[model samples]
Target: MPTIHSGPVCRLFVLLARDAPLGVVFRQGPRQLTQLFLWHTNTDTFEPGDRFVGNLSPERGDLSPDGKLLIYVAANYTMGHHNKGLPPRWTALSKPPYLTPLALWPNDEPYYLGGLFAARGSIEINLAPYALEDWREHKPSFPAGAPPEGLVFEYENLPWTPSNQLFTRLMRSGWSQVPTRQQSETVDIAFVKAHPTKPLSLVLGMGSGNSHTYTVHHEAGNAKTKLVGAVWADWDQRGRLVYSLDGKLFTAELDFPGKLQPSEIADFTTTARRRPPTPESASQW
Candidate 1:
């Protein structure tokens, strides 16, 4: 038996129960499984909760802070076919869904690097903004101007702050001058409690320069998680340090700084308010 703690998720297939104090969901394969687990710090053991099942693949999922609406994503498409038969039949070839209406976690897009959704918000007729080439011919059409007013960006870019923000790096080859301030796009900002008692910390991802970098911004006094050619998909908090990681579907604490060093990893699958830490063994002085 192991004791669970209240913290961030470090693995995939995690769901915090809304009714139960500590109901955690973990995936066994395609099917998601939930269990009631308890944390008995005295002996470092976990108790079990009732089981529930669901699906939460990264590409098709919707688990908000309160766990109410389950947003789902699927291809919205019409098929093309070649009908040539004595009886006049048709064959199905392709159905590609346009990806848009990607809801940034907690907010709609057009904001600085926000959480992305798989669903398209809207579709307008006669809006083939980008040039399309015949698949069989493999010939491309010349690029064009802005898309229709309602046309969404074909590809959505998540918030990512490049290193160049603080200082410019001089690259000898394949480099160009930084864009002037007027050319810079104002990015959307989302603030989460990075550390206890710290000023607002922002999920600094979207930048006018590059959309591939993700970094954390805190007041001058807090620890910073800088992007080093990686995307932080998930985050959890522990003693003094924020545990940022990937493939999280459950909660755990990262006992150290950065995502590099993790402390005694414990699962707090249940949603119970903070309880004083119960020592597994007698305190040592």
Candidate 2:
């Protein structure tokens, strides 16, 4: 068994850009250092980006459909903590693979942070409309040919929290919540999403204090295949299972059920922390 406090475990969480062949990968490791990478899904390549000394829950992050803009929570809450006159946490809109915000909103609380792109110009912050934005720093840059009028999305005032934030994304990705008998205090919630075309489903168990888990289950009452070393997993647009495992990204070929034919995509295990130039896209407007 691994020691609970052995040390900081390096891991990766990825947010695939909507309707684009790109991804924003959050590499968390070395305690206090969370780095970014722009991944090209088509080529299985990565471009290293900037790093920050804070926290980024990737589940609370989103990328624009154009794969040009990113919305995420940059939080570090400590009792009575202060950072050079900065808030403990804030929601930021930035260019992919960078922490420099094109726009910023001070989160009233941790749970109130994070956002998603609803359409070409519409954005939802905290599952709420763009009006909920605090407007601390408001300057959103769009790529060439993007509509400017619909930047603000119309969203319902739904209850938003760190937990439900994740659930919202899961539901959007075709996952349905499954009621679980909570026998322990740590057990929180779980969701399952079946393959769009396959007879298999992916089960996700995210607990209150326990570790998050993912497994592949056969809907034919056959087997529940636990993806070894899987920290996060989901079916990609190609019906392949893409997951970040042991500090690297991989895509599995589901040719044979109950067996994982894992193929490495990118090896992020050795990515060193460094300052990267602002991507050219963020430099405009």
Top TM-score hit = 2
lDDT tens per residue, model 1, 34-146: 32233222333444323323322222222232222222222212232113111111111001111112221111111111112223422211111121222233211212222
Question: CA RMSD for every model?
Answer: 17.8, 4.8
Model 1 misplacement above 4 A: 1-61, 76-196, 199-202, 207-212, 218-223, 227-230, 233-285
lDDT of each: 0.27, 0.71
Per-prediction tally of clashes: 33, 0
Query: Poorest 10 consecutive residues of model 2 by lDDT?
Result: 1-10
